[model samples]
Structures are given as structure tokens and as C-alpha cells.
Target: MDNHAITTRGLTRRFGAITAVDSVDLDIPRGGVVGIVGPNGAGKSTTIRMLLGLIEPTDGAGTVFGEPITRPKRYADRVGALIENPAFLPNISARANVQSMATLRGVPSDRVDDVLEIVGLSDRADDCVSKYSLGMKQRLGIAIALLPDPELLVLDEPTNGLDPAGIVEVRQLLRRLGDEGRTVVVSSHLLSEIEAAADYLVVIRFGKILFAGPLGDLLEQERRYVDLQPEMESEIEDLASVYTNAGYDVTIEPDTVRVVIDPVESANLNRLAIENGFVLRQLIRSNENLEDVFLRMTDANTEVAA
Candidate 1:
């Protein structure tokens, strides 16, 4: 049997004439945290809905637990998900909300308290959900998702509206969950969160996957750059031109030159700077992080289309 917790083959969804989720493929292995990141309206939520079988795809197929997604038996027992804003009875306590979901899923009653503890809401379990802050409500939603103890957990914008402390709590919880060998798929627009928490990532733009791989591999030397500062302020633009003429793509910021140098060109940059009589004050190698790459790629794509 396939060990994948989630898999999609050419999944597509459309609304009238507009394509909300284009042909997209995803494979999430069991017992790992895979992050999905994209801009607003980039189809992250649409893709999750298709995986949950809440919306049928316009074309192609997907599977959860190695069975076709359309089959409730395939996904029902193995997957727990929180997509978009989760609803709750305003008058009920946080614990009560989780217990209701556990009951609906036929999960044991004791699992309610277990999930509350996992989400760190045991102290406030008796407080009415309406009285809970936004972060508390979000944790309650997570607690509901956890109650079923499924093989896979999928959360959409799980940290939305959370304060810094709440964000840290959720991040730690996800790490703990993954360490325990549960497959996790967390979607967010926040690159920092993904960088700090996810082992693997799928970056999307305009409903299509731009890259999918290990986070470390994606941020390798080829995709990195350097920020160069010149000792002489007057020679800043001159140094930038020197780098540019040597075929390095250099962007002049207010006081530094952002240089995109490959393996071969990177070595040449240092040697050329010394030879050209420009004193290099700083040469800090920076991984043009996923966020930077996302912005650069999308902007170029937009400019080209325009």
C-alpha cells in the first residue's frame, strides 16, 4: 500500500469561466510537515477544499490514504482538516466545542480533554467561546481538528489573527505533532512561519506550483545572493556598474548593491572588486529567501504578461 497521506494528480477546479485552482499535483508523505504558501487568491484554499472532497474537481483525480478522494471511506477516517474560518456555537465553552466535534466523529469523550491539553486551552476550557480571544478561538479550532487523531492534519491559515505568543504556541504544537509521526499540511501566506516550521514546502503563484522541494535544497547557493557595501560612498554606483558589467545582476538599494551571483560569478565578484580599485567594506552572502524569490518571480511574471 502507498504510504502517502495525501496525493493529487492534475487536480483542477473552476468557477464559471474563471479557473480558481488550475491543474495542480501534490504528494504529502506520512509523518511530515509540508507547508503550502502563496499570495491571496492564489488558490491555496481552493486546493485544500478539493483534497477534503468538499468541492469536486473540474478534472483529474486525487487520493487520501491511497484511495480516490471521492470515496468517503478513503479520506474520512484518515484526515482531519480546518479550512477557512471554522464555526463554533458562541455560547459554548472551548472544551464544549471540541467535545461536540469529537462526538460527531464518534471519537471517545476523553479525547476532548486530551485535545484541549494539546492546544493549551485546558485552563480556559470552561470559558465561553464568545468570551475567548481570537487566538483562543483559533486554538479551539485546532483542538477540534486534533480530536479525531487522524493520520493527517490539514490547517489553513492556522495562525491568522494570533498574537506573537499564540503564534509561538501553535508553531511549537505543530513541531510536536510532526515529531510524533503525524502527517501535517499547513497553509499560510506568511513565509517566515513556513521557514521556521516546515521541513518541506510547496510554493505557488496564480494557482500553480512554482517550486516544491526540501526547504534547505530550495535555498541553496544557486538561489542565493549577496549584499555588497563599498567603503567609499561615492563609488557605490561605480562598484554596482562594475559588478553589472561583469554579468552579475545587481540592484542598487539606498546604500548597498544587491548582487545576484552564481557559483562561477560569485568568485569573480570578489577578485574583480579588489582588482578594480574598489574597497569592499562588506560582502554578506544572503539566501534570497522564499519570500524574496516569490516577490521577484511574481513581479517578473506580471511585467512580462503586461
Candidate 2:
């Protein structure tokens, strides 16, 4: 079997004149959570649909468990997906909804109970889906996906409509699934949630990959910004101008200054400040996370488009 649980090469999908998903490549390994993040209309959903074989790609090809995605039966039992907001039989109970999935997929009857428990829906398993809260319904959708006990789980906006408590619950569930040695892929527009839940991230913009790797490594690659806090407010502008005159991007806040500088520039600025007799009370280098990277990349794209 291929080591990668999911692999896509030049995946592209078009809707007549508009290209919903452009050429994209991704490889998700086993036993880890890979977060897919992008702005609205950035092809995150389109990519998920293509991966599930729900929509055929206009160009390129992909595989789930090394089997052609186009041939769903080849790896259908090994892949579980909550493509989007799932449709349920509102009149029936949550457990029944999952049982229906098991029936259609020829999954074992006992698996429904197991998945409901896994998603924390066992307490209200018998509750009619119509009466369940949005968060509960979301869990039911996941229960349906897990009925087959697939090795890979794909969740798109799993926290959508979830309350704060529900969000935490879902995050914990994803972490637990990863601990059990199952490959997980989560797609969301919320970078903060991704930062907390995902180990690695694949950030896409305008349907193209902007970055792909461990979250920590990506932040390390970007220039570090130093936040400086000083005692005197009146002298802050002068201190900022000192760096700005030296060609650094200096952003001054109420009580802090955000100085974006490369390593070489950082060294020079530090030396220059001391030489000029500026008392620097505090200075700390900041390594930005996935959220910062996402904002920078997406904002740059917007500027280019404008």
C-alpha cells in the first residue's frame, strides 16, 4: 500500500468559465492531521469534493489509499468523509441515521454504536436528529462517516455552527483520532482552530499552494518581528523613525512597536539603537504562527488582485 493515505497531482476542476480548483498537489501521510486552509473561494471546498470523488477533476488525478479516487469501490471502505454539512433523515434518531449509513455501506451493525460513542453522541443517540442541536447534528454526521471504521477521516468545517464547548470537543476528538494512528484531514477557513488542531498545514490561495509543512517550521521560515516596549511614550515615534529611516517596516502600537526585520537587519537596528543612546526597555522576537502566515499570504493575494 502507498505510504500516503491521500495524494493528489495537478488536481484541477472547472465549472465552465470559472476554474473552481486549479492545479494542486498534496500528500497526506498516515497518523497525522493535515489542515487545509484558505480564504473564501480559495478552492478549499472544491479540493475536498474532488478528493472524495464527488466531483471529477477537469485535469489531473488523485488517489485515496493508493487506489484511484474515480474508482470509489477500490478504497471506499478505507476512507471516511464528512464532505460538508451532511443531509440526514430529520424524522429519525441520530443512531438510526448512522445505522442507515451502515446499512447502505454494508458496514457492521455494531460499528454504529462504536462511532456514536467516539463522537460523543451516545448520550443523545436516540434523540431525533430534528430535535438535536446543530453541534449534535454535526457529530451525527461524523458518526455516519465513521460507521465504516475507515483508516482515514476527512472533516470539512467540522466546527461550523458549533458552540465554544463543541469546538473544544471536536478538537479533542481529532487529536484522539490522530493518537490512534489514523490519518486525518481537516479543512477550515478559521486559522486559529487549525492552529490548535492541526500538526501540519497546507495553505492554498487562488487554488495554488502557498506553503505546506509543519506549522512551526513555516513560522520559523518567515522573518521574525520584534515587539519593543519602552517607558516613554513621547520618544516612541523617534525610536520608530530610527528604524524606519534604516529601511525596516516599523509599526507602532499604543504601548508596543512591531518591527519586522530580517536577521541581518535586526542586528544592525539593535546596534544602531544602542549607539544613538535610545533606552530599549524590552525587546522580544516573535515567531508568527499559521494565523499570521495565512493573513500575510491572503492579504498579499488581495493586494495583487486589486
Candidate 3:
């Protein structure tokens, strides 16, 4: 087994003259969970398809478990994937559906029961697929994928369309699967879900790599700022000038002056306000959520340092 589960360089794909996935590079390591996240149509699915050897890349190459993706047979047996949407025979029982897939793959029917428990579908395994909720159906897809006992599991937007509880259910399952030492690659647009579930994060937008690194490292890249609200609204402009004149990036607001500065420099901001004879009623440093950080990065259209 390779230390890296998948790797690509200059990977590209085009739909006629329109490039869907630009020159993208990826190095996905084995074990734990890796998240390939971006806005809708940011080439997440295309990249996965290329890796799965489902679609040919216009340029570059890659490998899975050290086997060339061009030769899927070399490694196909070890990879299980639930891509796009999972459509099961609506009329049949979940157990029957899972059992049918298991039989097709030459996997013993006993494995179906094991997988049902793994996905928390044991209780509804005998119920018709038509009676299952969206979340339950998604789990059935995962159960089918697990029947083969794949070393690498690829799930594209497994939590898409799931409700709050369903999202939580899938999130916990991903964490459990990763802890078991399997390489799980999941792609989703929901930043919160990925933030809570993924160990490594790959951010992409407009068919390009914005960032790819450990989740903590990406969070660390979010800039810190101090928000100062003067007691007198009239003094807001003057207070903002104090930082601007000193060469700090400052944004004037209706009541507060937003200063982009290291949190440790918060004391300096207070001193500056006091020196400028501006009374501050409130001064707070706000922490940004993942959505805030990601939106800012993508809006700037700049590559984030890995």
C-alpha cells in the first residue's frame, strides 16, 4: 500500500473548449478522512471521476494506491465509491438491495448484515427502500460500498440533502470510518460538515486549487481583527484615522472601526484610541467561522498557501 492513496499533477479535463478542471494537483494520503470541498461545480466531482478512471483527463496523470489510474483494474478491487446520487430499487427491501449488490460482487450475504449495522441501518434493513428517508437511503449506499470491504472509500456529497440530524449522523459515521484506519475521501460543499468531520481539507473554486492542507492549518490562515466601537458615533471617523494614519488597514463602519491586526495588538488599538482622545464604549475581537474565511478567500480569487 502507498503512503499516499492518490496523487495527481497538472490534472486537467475539458468539455470541448471549455475547461471544467484546470491544471489541478492533488496529493491525498492514506488513512483518516480527506475532504475535497468547494462550491458547486468547482471540479470536485470531475477530479474524483478522473481518479476513479470513469472519465479520461485531457492532460496529466494520477495513481491510486500506487497503481496508475489509467489502469483501474490494477486497483479497482480495493476502492469503493458512492458518487453523485445513490439510486436503489425503490420497491425492494433495503436488505434485499444490499444483498443483491453483495451477491453481484461475490461478497457473502453475511457481510450485508455487518454493513447494515455499520451504517445504522440494521433496524430498517428489511423495510422497503421506498419507505426510507433520504438519510437512510444514503446510508444504504454506504452499506453497498462497504460490502466489498474496500481499502479506500470515496463518497461524493454523502450528506447532500440531509437534514440536521442526518448530517450529524453522516458526520459521526465518517469520523468512525476514518478512525478505523481506512482512507475515506468525501466531497461536499457544506463547510460546517467538513470542518467538523474532515482531518485534511482541500479547497477549490472555479476549477482551481485554492488550498490543500491539514484542516487546522487552513483555519489558522484566517486573519484576526479588532473591532472598536467608540462611545460617541461622531468619533468613529477620527478613531479610524488613527490606525489608517499609522498604516494599519482600517475599515470605517457606522459605529465601529474594524482594524485588521494581530489579536496581541488589541492593546495597541486601545492605546491609540485613548491617545486620540476617543472614548470607546466597546471593543471586541470577533472570531470568524469557516464560511466567513472561505468566502473571503474565494471572493479574492487567490491561492491559499498549503
Candidate 4:
């Protein structure tokens, strides 16, 4: 079997005059969660749809489990997907809905109980679909996907419209699934959720891939900063000049000064401040969060396009 669960090379898709997904290359491994992030209209949905064989690519090629995407049946049984909103018979019980889906897929009905337990919905298995919360409904969508015993699970904004508690619940579930060695691909607008749940990331912009790699690697690429507040507000300008002369990006505020520097240089920064007669009231290092890094990348891409 291929080590990669999914791979695409120069995959492109166009709708009339608009290119929904440009030439894109992706290599998703067989285990762990990979988060795909992009601004609206960045082609995330279009790319996923092509991978699932719901839409054909206009150029290039892709494979799922080493089988050509065009021949979906070869790998379809091993994959499960939840894209956009999950549809269910609103008036029916969750169990009945799962049973009906199982019947259509020819999946054994016995798997329904197992999937419900995996998604933490076994207790409410008999509840009417309409009565379930948004989070519970999302869990049901995931349960339906799990019925196939898929090796690869694709979820698009699984936490969309969820409350904080629901988001946490779904995040933990995805982590657990990846820990169990299942390959999971998820897309979300929630950067913090993605940072917490995904081990790897793929960032896209304007229908093009901007970045792809381990989440740690992406974070490390961003410059760290030191936030400093002097004992006297008047010293802010002098402190900014000191860091600026030392070749650092300095942001001066009324109460604090933020200096973008390597973490190792933080001690040097403090030493210079003291040497310059600036009494430091507070000095704290702040790392760039995932949202910050994501915005920086996308913004850079936008500038380049301009």
C-alpha cells in the first residue's frame, strides 16, 4: 500500500472563465490529522470535491490510496467524507438515519453502534435528528462517514456553527481518530482549532497553495517578539530607537514596545535596555500564534499577486 493516503500533482479545476482550483500539489500521509486553511473562495471546497470524484479536474491528476481519483470505486470504499452541511431526515431518529444510510451503502448495520460511540452520540442514538444540537448533528454526519470503516476521512468545517463546547468536543474526537492511525483531512476557518487539532497544515490562497508542512515548522518560520514596558512612559521612544538601531522591527505603543527578534536575542534586548538607562517594568516574550502566521502568509501572497 502507498504510504500516502492522498496525493495530487498539478491538479486544476475551472468553471467557465473562473479557475476554482489552480495547479496544486499535495501529499497527505496515511495517518494523523491535516488541516487545510484558506480564506473564502480560496478553492478549498473545489479541491476537496475533485479529490472525492464529485467534480473532474480540468488538468493534472490526483490519487486516493494510490488509485486514480477518476476511478473512485477503486478507493471509494476505503474513504468517507462530510462536505458542507450534512443532510439527514430531520424527523427520524439518529439510529434510523444511520440504519438507512448503512442499508444504502451496504455497510453492516452492526457498525452503527460502534460509530455512534466513537462520536460520543451513543447516549442520544434514539433522539430525533431535529432535536439534536448542531454539534450533535455534526457528530452524526461524522458517524455516517465512519460507517464505511474508512481509512481516510475528509471533513470540511466539521465545527462550523458549533458552540465553544461543541468545537472542543469535535477537536478532541479528530485528535483521537488521528491517534488511532487513521488519516484525517479537515478544513476550517477556525485557526486556533486547527492549530490544536492538526499535526500538519496546508494553507491556500487565491486557489493556490501557499504553504504546506508540519504545523511546528510553519510556526517556527514566524519571528518571535518581546513585549517590553518601561518604568516611565517617556522612555518608549528611546527603547524603540535602541531596538531599531540594533536591526529589529519595533512597534512603539504608549505603554509597551514590541520588538520582533529571535527568541535567543531576548536576553540581549534586556541587557541593551538596562545599559541605556531604561528601567524595565515588564519584559515578556510573545510567540506568533497560528492566526498571525496564517494572515502573514496570505497577506504576502496577496501582495505578490498585486
**Pick by lDDT: 1 or 4, better one:** 4
The models' CA-based lDDT, in order, is 0.82, 0.83, 0.87, 0.89
Tens digits of lDDT, candidate 3, 1-306: 468999888899999987878899889888989998888988899999998999999998888999888998888778888888887999999999998988788888899999999998899899999999888889889888888898899999999778888889888988988999888999998677788988999998877888998999888887788899999888888888889999998988677899989878899999988888888899889766678788877766744522
Give residue 294's lDDT in candidate 1 (0 to 100). 63
* Distance from true location, Cα of 176 in model 4, Å: 1.4
Estimate the overall C-alpha local distance difference test score of candidate 1.
Answer: 0.82
Candidate 2: global Cα-lDDT? 0.83
Candidate 4 residue-wise lDDT, 255-305, digit = tens: 899998877778898999999988899998888777888987898889997
Which residue segments of model 1 deviate by more than 4 Å?
Answer: 226-246, 250-257, 262-287, 304-306
User: Please, what are the lDDT tens digits per residue for candidate 1 over residues 111-135?
Assistant: 9999888888899999999998888
Two-way TM-score contest, 1 vs 3, winner: 3
Candidate 4 stretches with Cα past 4 Å from truth are: 226-259, 263-286
Tens-place lDDT digits, model 2, residues 1-306? 688887889999899998877788888777778888888788999998887878889999998888887887788788888877867999998888888888999988888889998888888999899998888888888888777777888998898889999999989988888788888899888888887878888888888877777877776766578877665767788888888887888888778777987544555666777877777777777766656778888887777767
Is 2 or 3 the stronger prediction by lDDT?
A: 3
What is the lDDT for 54 in model 4? Answer: 93
Colliding pairs, model 2: none
- Evaluate residue 215 in candidate 4 and report its C-alpha lDDT on the 0 to 100 scale: 91
